[model samples]
Target chain A: MSEKQKKASAYWKENVRYLFILLAIWFAVSYGAGILFKDTLNEIKMGGFELGFWFAQQGSIYVFVILIFAYVRLMNSLDKKYGYDE
Target chain B: MDVQTWTYLLVGITFSIYIGIAIWSRAGSTNDFYVAGGGVSPLANGMATAADWMSAASFISMAGIISFAGYDGSVYLMGWTGGYVLLALLLAPYLRKFGKFTVPDFIGDRYYSKTARIVAVICALIVSFTYVAGQMRGVGVVFSRFLEVDINTGVIIGMVIVLFYAVLGGMKGITYTQVAQYCVLIFAFMVPAIFISIQMTGNPIPQLGMGSRLNDGSGIYLLDKLNGLSTELGFAEYTDGKKSTIDVFMITLALMVGTAGLPHVIVRFFTVKRVRDARKSAGLALLLIAILYTTAPAVSVFARTNMINTVSNKEYTAMPEWFKNWETTGLLAFDDKNGDGKIQYVADPSKNELTVDRDIMVLANPEIANLPAWVIALVAAGGLAAALSTAAGLLLVISASVSHDLIKKVFVPSISEKGELWAARGAATVAVVIAGYFGINPPGFVAAVVALAFGLAAASFFPAIVLGIFYKKMNKEGAIAGMVVGISLMLFYMLKFKFGIFDGGKEAVPGLEKDWWFGISPEGFGSVAMLVNFILSIAIMKFTPPPPENVQEIVEDIRIPSGAGEATGH
Candidate 1:
């Protein structure tokens, strides 16, 4: 393969790795903290809410928005690292 | 001015703005009609997508659903927003790189099968039409309540207004109108939320106010007070679960995947310029959506607490005007089953006398809080905006599927671009009328049917699109088989459990309720269907021949970030 093709493959691999890591965080917040461990997390308080209730109703959504932007930033940097940025 | 006049004025003004934008940005070509000439900025596309994504269900019904269902309603919240994460990370950028006008165009090309394209078009039509029906109903409700028109008249008016812009401007017109709609809706949504939040917790932001101590010198968290009131009335705790844990998990997963899979929402990503813009636009859309989603739970808390404190055990004669107003519309009913003048809003089926339709919580919220006439009118306009924007988006997809995918691409490849554009316009006009008809003469189960649209999208399209992009060896055969099986399984479950088919002409098949597979409701069954699709596709691909070399090359091309400029029209 050409050098540029090799570099593109490496960049794609890195991108997938970042995607999985970000998605794992996404799964943890919504399904894990919000639904599965909600009762356990409810034992802790954040201001006026049980931690779990907050996660289910409010916290997971906040995390989701943040996670998207974080992924965008990570991918942007990865693009630069592999000289794929337009 | 009275609330009625105010509503008419605001709604009229918003309609005028939409029409003006439609005229100003009318499409000049087929590409313009399909993808807004592929020139929309990421931020503007984000706001448009926010408007497109936040349908009438989110604007008018979600808080009400949450208000009644309590913690179970978290599924809608997590499900909807979480999908954007999947979109941003997994789907949007690649799809944007593919640079297509319609989803079926991508599916058909990527799978290299006309039959696969046809299946996608069918799924897209069913999903879009079912969803648009709910939006039309939302428009009708706002009109009937605020403008004093019959529901039929309201629906007809909504149809005419939508037909004007959607036919004239296409995606170009709809994109700008949706941006304006995003403004009107977010403003309308936030104003009442701020008012109620301050009144309840002495805080301005509804998100924080929901967690703040009550302003009534109770020193208790608002949620705690709500939970106390609910249990006092024999209801489940406001912060606890009612549905089984597995059901919640499954439903949330279905909604998230469904949101990602929805054709209308996914098509919005194609309007932007670059792969990076697609990612940015998804983030912005989620940020815009998060504003209302987070506020919805807070609004539920406020509305619930206010309703319980104001009406429970109160004499009917002393009930608030909002209650009487909604009662006139038959949305709020009080049976007084115990023969007492006092009303009891509780969880006990026998003792509860108040039957507040879940749609009323969001609609009646402004009046319930005694907000200004202008704010009430703004809400009417906001609800119309939300419904109209989404309806127009979905109708465009339906129209494009007919004109671009089916008629031109498949049946008559010789049709000129101008002919195809006119055909799309004609199809959109008919679609709007049909959606309006469903709105006026609603099939008594529009919302339930609409919920099934998400499940269908989740089961059929999400798996196919995701696998087509990520799994290089996924052949046309496995993809088609997977979509067919996934959609058929979801349809069978919905038909048998929800509609009660196969009962020898009985409306409800016996024992279906008790015999749900693993206690998963039909709404949650999409997740199982999706899992089956994934497993079936992978297993089938192992045995089937791999995709053609050119198809694999196309996949590799879309995976990269560069060279995503304008999309080429078929």
Candidate 2:
């Protein structure tokens, strides 16, 4: 393979890895804590909130925002590492 | 001033601001028309996307729906917002790098087929129109309730304002006005919420207020009080959900994927200058959207609690003037069954004398809380902003589908730029009138069709676009087959279950729910259809020839985030 193709492939591989990690967290918060394990999590409480219900309504959304910004920070650094930054 | 005068003033001022922005940002070329010349800043695009994504439903109906549905409504809260994560991580950066004017542009180029492009256009139009009709109706609802105007007249006025900006400035005009609209809608949504939050819990922030102790000297958490009240009326606990876990999971997945696939939202990323800007703006858009989303549940808790307290077992004649006003609008009604002069809003359908429409929760919130007339009126203007901004954005997508995707790419490839621009404006004009007609005379199936739009989008575009980018070997045959099969499967399922067309008809729908595939609702069936699309596409690709080498090269190119040029028609 050409040097450029190899570097591109490497960059793409790293990008895919980051996506997997980030999306796992995304899945864990919303589907896991918020839905599937909700009954179990609701056994705990945070102030006025049941732990599971909070994740379903409010907590999951806050985590989603944080996940995106975190993805942005991670992707930016990766772009710079791969010298793909403009 | 009273509510009418305040509404007129605020709505008038906000309309003038939109018109002013439209004139300032009018598109001159097809590129400018499609993507604001691909030069919008991240902050501006972020705000525009927020306004564009948060439609009339988000502004006028979501909180109210959440208020009644309680924990079950998290499907919307999580579904809508989680899609931005998919967009930011999986879709936005790549599509922005492709430098396309529309979603179909990428599908067409990547699949190397006019067939793929046309299929995409049809899907985009169907999804957009289904969604847009709801927005126009929202505009009409807001106008009639606040200004006391006729619903048809309200729709026409909405049509005229949208026609002016969307036809003249296109996406360029829509983006800037949406920024202004975002400011208006968020401010309008937040003010009353903050007020109610303080009144109920002594917390200024609505999100925290929901979890704080009530200020009524009861020292109980607001949610606990709401739960107690709900149970007292034979309703489920406020934080508990009634939807089956499988259905909730599938529905949330469908909405998130469908949201990522929406052409109007996807096109907003094209307006930015870089792939990085696309990523940043997705983050910003979600952050901006999260502001309203997080507060909605708090507003829901407050509104539901206040509603039950005010009217339950209360004498009908003693109700507030706002109740009478809403009654005249036919959104709220009290029949006082058993001839008892008091309203009974119990869980039992037979005993529930007071029938309240969920759509009124947010609109009537300010009046229910006795906020100032100006704050009440501000919601009217805010609803208009949300509706108009989204309508304009969808209109742009519809017009672009007609002019750029169909005319330029398919039928009349030899057309000049100026000629194409005129065609776009003409399409916008026609789309607005059609949308206005639907707004004035909405079909009986309008509400049912809205959820179907998300299912259709998920079944078709999400799979097609994802495969086009991620799997280099995916051919036109696979994509075309997948889109056709996916969309058809979704429609068949939706018709069979949602409309009961394959059964006896709409009346048979309740009985057919027992036979749902794996107990998933029609709204969540998109996930099933999408999975079938993915599987069938791969199977078809294994037999068919792979996409051309150049197409594969384009896939590899979009993977890197550098050198994204201006969004172009070609």
Candidate 3:
């Protein structure tokens, strides 16, 4: 196959990798700390907020926001390498 | 200045500023009107999006929800903000890269069916209008209280303010004004919070104050004290969560998916100049919004702690001036049910006033803490800003549906850019008038209705848009069938529960009124509906004809975003 097709295939693989990793984290934090592990997390403390409370209120959101920016950054670089970026 | 006069002057000045910004940033074309000409920087767009997304509901009701729910309230904070991650990661960049003006455009084109487009249009209208109705009601509430007018007059005035800019300015007008509104509402939210924070705990940040030691210098955690106090009065512990574990999880999921599905928020992503910019804006928007979401839990703790300490098991005569003042607005009431002069507020279902509206907690906080009048005024202005900015964004969605989706796409395929532009303005005016009517005579429960809006969006729009990009086999028939079934299920379920339609006797809807489906509230079933939508579309697609090759090309082009490859002739 030509170099272009090979690069496009690589791009597709990378997109799949990033999406799977991010989805895993999304499920883990929101579902994991929020409801699934509430009791276990309650044992911990962050200042006045309990360990579970922190995850419920701020931790999940902070992580989700970070993942989005990271994806964008990663995608932009991938786009350039694939001759897709503007 | 007298506190009353200063409040009048302050609110008036803020209104004028919003108007001025709206006129200055008037959209010049249909594209300009819908997506701000796609030149907005991620940072500004993010702030405006945050301001637009965080409505009166988030600003006013969230803390109250938390205060009562205690640890369980985390569902809201996590669920509400978690959707942004989904939006930014799974949706925003591709949609921005697709470079469409509206959500339906993507669904319609990718699905390769005008039927899909019409289905999307219906979903968008239902979602946006249902959501806008709540914001309009919130605007009326703020206006009636601070402006010293009746609810009817307040709704009329609120309508004019929203129409002034949304009709004339479009998304461009709403965007700039929202930037200003974000500032007003955030400052108002933080100042009082910080003061209360420092007063209660040595910590100045409300987030820190929450977990910090109480003012009595007791080494015990504040959460523990709150738990003890509330349980003593028969309310659920402030620390222990009481809702069914499955239900909380479902509600959180529904809220997250619903947030991701909102068209107005997604439309904001199209305003950015590049795909990467859309990503940056998501982060920045989350940061801006997190400032409030994180602090709100602290507000819940502080307000709950203070109210329990002051009003619970206490005499009415000892109550502060703010109590009587707020009572006039009907936001706070002391029924003294036992007629014992002292008012005892406890979570104990039997003894509590059982009447405290969640919205009142934030508004009454300033007075409860005895903060000065200006801060109170600022809170009023903030409430208005939160309501108005979000109302404008939702209104833009409503207008664009008529002009861009209906008139341009459905009615007149050959409509000129200028004609489409005028049509948008006309649609916006009509939307404003209609929203005003709902605001004046709000239908049923405002919060419940708003939840239905999210369910509709999640069930109908999210599936079509997501499938359009990833599933090349999803034809127009599948898309339309999916949306119709998904939204109808949501509508029927919500209406059945709300009106008791299913019950056989005078009060019907037997199982619905007795129990929510699967213990999930009507508002939260959206996530389930969306899942059903996805399943139905995929299942049916296996038996149906696939979309033509050209539609596959559109999906591939959206995925790659290399260039404006081709324009399929309408």
Candidate 4:
């Protein structure tokens, strides 16, 4: 394979890795903390909210917005690394 | 001015502004019509996307649903917003890099099959049309209540206004109008929320106020008080889970995938200039949406606590004006079953004499609190903005599918650009009329029917688009088979359980019952169907010849962000 092809493949691999890591964080927050472990987490409270309930209702959405921007930043730098950014 | 006069004025002013914007930004070319000439700024596109994504359901109905469902309602709060993450990371930037006018354009070119495109067009049409019906109904509901016109007339008025803007200005017109809509809607939503929050907890931010202690010297946390009131009235605890964990998991998953896969929402990314702009736009859209979403639960809590404190066990003869007014609309009904001359709104099926339809809480909030007439009027205009903005977006998708994908791409490849543009406008006209008809005479539970649109999109498009971008080896045969099987499974489940086909009609399908498969409701089954699609597509691709070299190259091109420019017409 050409050097350019190898570089492109490596860029794609890093992109997929970042995606999996970020999405895993997403799953952990929403489905894990919010639903499956909610009952246990309810034992703890945050400013009058059951911790799990807060995660489900408010925290998850806040984290999701942040995650997207983080991904955007990560990808922009990744694009620069691979000379893919304009 | 009186509330009625105020409503008319506000609604009239907003409608005129939308029409004025439409005339100012009329589309002159196919590119202008499809993706607003692909020149929309990220911030503006973000606002338009928020307006487009938050339909009548999000604006008018979600709080009401959250109010009643309590913990179960988090499905929507999480499911809807979570999709943007997937869209940003998995779909939006890649699709923008491809620079397509519509979703089926991607599917057709990526898979190198007109047949796959046709299948995608069918899915897009079904999803958009089903979704648009709900938006039209929302517009009708707002108009009839505020204008005191018959529902049919209200529907017709909405139809005419949407036709003017959607057909004339196309995506360009829709984008600017939606920016206006987002402002009107967020103002409409937030103003009342701030008022109620201040009233309830002396905290102006509803998000913080919902968790704060009540200001009535009760010294009790608002949620704790709400929970006590709910259980005392025989209702479940406010924060307790209602549906099984698996069902919640599945429903949230379905909604997330559905939100990511929706054609109208994905198409918004194409209107922006660069692939990086697409990522930023999705983030901006989520931030805008979060402003509403996070507020909805707070509003739900405030409405519920206020409703219970005001009305529960109160004498019927002295019921408040808002209660009596809503009762007249049949949305809030009361029956003195025990003849005690007192209303009992309990969780017990037989004892609860008051039946409160969930839709009224948001609409009646300002009146319930005795706020100024103008606030109520603003809400009426806000609901209209939410409904019209979404309907316009969905209608564009429907028209593009019919005119661009079906007519120009598949049937008449030699059609002139001018001819195709006319066809798109003609299709938009037909779509608006059909949506108006549905609004006038709704076929089924509009919101429930719209939920099926989400499930179908999740089952059909989400896997195809995600895989088509990520998995270069994915072929036409796999995509077609995946979409067909996925959509067919979802339709069959919805028809069998929701509509009661099959099973010899012996008993109702176990939608939320223990008899369900792992207690997964029909709404949640789409996640399973999506899983099936992913597995089926990968398995089929393993045996089939790989997608052609050119198709693979296109996939590679979309992955890289450099050299992405304006999307051109086919």
Candidate 5:
């Protein structure tokens, strides 16, 4: 395989890895804690909020923002590493 | 000043500002018309995307819905915001790198088939029109209530204003105007929230105030107090949900996926200059949106708690002026079903004497809280901004699909650039008129249809676009088949279950819940349909010829982050 093709594949591999990791957290926070395990998480309270309720209404949104920014940072570095940065 | 006078002043100023921006940013070419010349900065594009994404539904009705739905409302909060994460990660960067003028442009070019593009165009048109009809209704409601204009007059005024900016300035005008609208709506939303937060819990932040102790010195958390109040009134607990867990899971997934597939939101990414800008702008848009989305639940809690405390079993004659004012609008009505003079707001429909519309939670929040009249007026302006901004965005999507995708690419491939621009403006004008008609005389099914737009988008576009990018061998035949089958299944379910077209009609919909597929409501059935679309597309692709070598190469090119250029008509 050509060097360029190999580099593209590597960059894509890293990108997909990041996506899986980030999306897992996304699924965990919203589907797992917020829904599937909500009753379990509700047993624990943070201040006045049930842990499950907080995750669903507020915490997931915050985590989503952080995850996007983190992806941006990671992608920027990856692009630079692969010389894909414009 | 009175609320009426203050509303007039603020709405007048904001309308003038939008018109002025439109005149200044008039589209000079087709590029500008379609994508604001493809040179918008990340921040400006981010602000525009936020304004476009948060419609009248988000601004006006979401808090009220959440106030009533309690824990079940988390689907909206997580669903809407979580889609941005998907867009930022999977769709936006690649689509921007493809550097297209519209979603259909990507589908048409990547799939190498006109049939794929036509299907995409139809999907875009259906999704956009259904969504825009609701915004026009929202604008009219805000106007009739706050400005004392006839609903038809309000819709006409909305149409003229949107026509001026959308036809004249196109995406350029819409983008700048949306930035201003975002500021107006968010400020209008936050001020009352902050005030009520401090008033009720002695906490300045509404998010924290929702969890803090009540200012009544009862030493009870607000949620706990609300729970007690709710149970006393025979309602569910404030933090508990009535929806089954599986239904919540499906609904949240459907909304999140649908949000990512929305044409208006996805088009905002194309307006940015580079792939990186698309990624960054998507993140910024969500951050801007999260400011309001996170505040909505808090606002809901505050509004609900205040409403119950003030009105439940309270003497009708001693009610506040705002209560009387809202009652006059027919949104807050007291029937006095019992011979007693007190209001009974219980869970049982037969015994409940007070009928409060859910929309009143957000619209009458400031008045209920006794904030200044000007603050109440600001909310009217904000609601109008939210409605108008989203309507403009949807109208652009409709116009682009019709003129650019249908006329320019398919039928009039040889049409001049200037001619195409004229066609786009004409389409926008026609779309505005149709949307206005729907607004003035909303079909009985308008609200039901709006929710189905997301479901339809989820069923049709999400799988096609994702495969068009990620799966190199996904042929047009597979995509077309999948979209047709997927959307048909969704439409069938929605009609049978939501509109009840098959089983006699709307009256039968109540009993139809027991027959739901996997106990999923029509709203959440999109998840099931989308999964089918994915499985069918891949399965069909295995038996058919792969996409051409050039199309596969195009997919590879979009994967790289560099060298995204200005959007151009092919």
Candidate 6:
């Protein structure tokens, strides 16, 4: 295999690892914390917004939007880094 | 003018505008017929997609669903938008880089199998057509209520208007028309919501108005009051949890995955000129969608709180015109349960009226808040636009799948380009007639059937397409087997309950444990099936041989957007 292709493969491996970690965080906030731990997180409050309530209403959505943008930025950088970019 | 008359006028005008736009923006070329000439900018495509994705479900139904389901309805909110993230990250870019005319083409070429492509085309048709029928039904319902037309007339009128532009403009026309539809629908959604929020919470922003202190300043949240009323009415607590945690999780996962898999939504990605733009557009489209999604729960809370407060012990004589108007549409009917002159709308089991169609709650919300009639009419137009935009998108996919994927590619590869375009128009014309028929006489469980559309998409297509791109070793045999298993399992389960296994018309009710396996509801079980698809496909591919080295090079090329220039139906 060519050196550039090998480098591209290595880049994707690192990228997939990062994606999994970020996805795990995404899942925990929306599916895990906001949902499964709703009652538990209700104990904590944030300026008239309970932690769990905020997560259900706005926190998770905000986090998802941030995650998508972050993935775009990170992926673009990695793409350029490994010569896989357009 | 009275609110009703004004609403009628605005509704009429909006339809004309939509038809006018459809005519002016119609596609003129074969490429325009297919991918809007593949020149749509990321931002424009993003708006078009947001309009396409947020259907009558979002505009008319989502808030009402959230109002009643309370915290549990977050599944719809998260699942629908979250799928876009999955699409942008895992699917959209690669699919765009594949540079295909239709999804079946990708499956056909990547798997290197004719049977697999045919299977994909069938799945796409069923899901797209079934989903489009639901949209048409929604449009018919909206038109019948607003314009005082018969439901059949409403459905037929909608069919003609849609056929007028959908057949003429193709994807190019649909994209621009969808942009206009998005504006109308969003405006329609927000105006009344803003008014209601002000009346209920004295806040201007409906989204914040939901969490704000109520007018009473009782130091209690609005959700608490709604929850109290619901529990008092014999319904589950509005904010308190009701569904099992596992069912909620699975359902949310299914919806999110299903959203990503939907052919109509995925095809929007192809309209953009570059792969990178597809990624950007997905993010922007989500941003636009999040505006309504974030506000919907708030709108539901506002509407429900005011509704219960106003109607809890109110005399029927003093009820407003909004109540009477919706009654004519059969959206709001009150049966005097206790021989009392007053109508009690509490969540109580025996006493409260059981006649509210959730669709009315959002559309009727403006008048419920005593807002002006123009806002109500705007909502009427908005609801139709939402349903029509999605219906148009689905119709395009169905037509393209038949003409581009099945006919031009598979059955008649030697057909001329002009002949293929005519075939596409013909497919669209046929789809419109069928859609109208189903709209008028929808099969039982129309709502539930449409919900299954996402499941089919999730179970069958999502895994194969994503794996085909990301996993180098995933083979044709694995793709076909995974799709067959995923979709079959979901269909078997749905048919068991929906149509009754062998009994034709009768249904047998299963106990809680029997109804759900692994605590997953049918609406959300697609995610589980998808997981099965991914795991088994990988396992099978490990034992079987991978694609040849030349195929590996194609995979590598698809990873880079620039390499897509040479690909045609690739």
How do the residues B427-533 of candidate 6 rate in per-residue lDDT, one tens digit apiece? 99999999999999998777888888888899999999998888877898899989999999889877765556644645535453465677677777788889988
Which of candidates 1 and 6 reaches a greater lDDT? 1
Listed in order, the DockQ scores are: 0.90, 0.93, 0.70, 0.87, 0.91, 0.54
Interface RMSD of 3: 1.8
* Reference-based lDDT, residue B174, model 3: 91
The list of candidate 5 runs beyond 4 A from truth reads none
Each candidate's clash count = 0, 0, 12, 0, 0, 4
| Runs in model 4 lying further than 4 Å from the true structure | B504-512
| lDDT for residue B464 in candidate 5, whole number 0-100 | 93
User: TM-score of model 6, chain A?
Assistant: 0.87
Off by more than 4 A, model 1: B504-511
Candidate 2 ranges beyond 4 A from true positions: none
TM-score pick, better of 5 and 6: 5
lDDT of 1 by residue, B402-446 (tens): 999999889999999999999999999999989988998888667
Model 6: number of backbone collisions:
4
lDDT of 2 by residue, A5-80 (tens): 9999999999899999999999999999999999999999999999999999999999999999999999999999
**Candidate 4: lDDT of B413?**
90
Cα deviation in Å at residue B533, candidate 5?
Answer: 0.3
List lDDT for all candidates, in order: 0.93, 0.93, 0.82, 0.93, 0.93, 0.83
Lowest-scoring 10 consecutive residues by lDDT in candidate 5 chain B? B502-511
Tell me the docking grade of candidate 5: high
Off by over 4 Å in 6: A83-86, B217-219, B346-348, B502-515
For candidate 6, give the DockQ: 0.54
The CAPRI category of model 4 is high
What is the Å distance of residue B18 in model 4 from its true position?
Answer: 0.5
Q: Which candidate do you rate higher for DockQ, 3 or 4? A: 4
lDDT of 3 at B21: 98
| Sort by DockQ, top down from the best | 2, 5, 1, 4, 3, 6
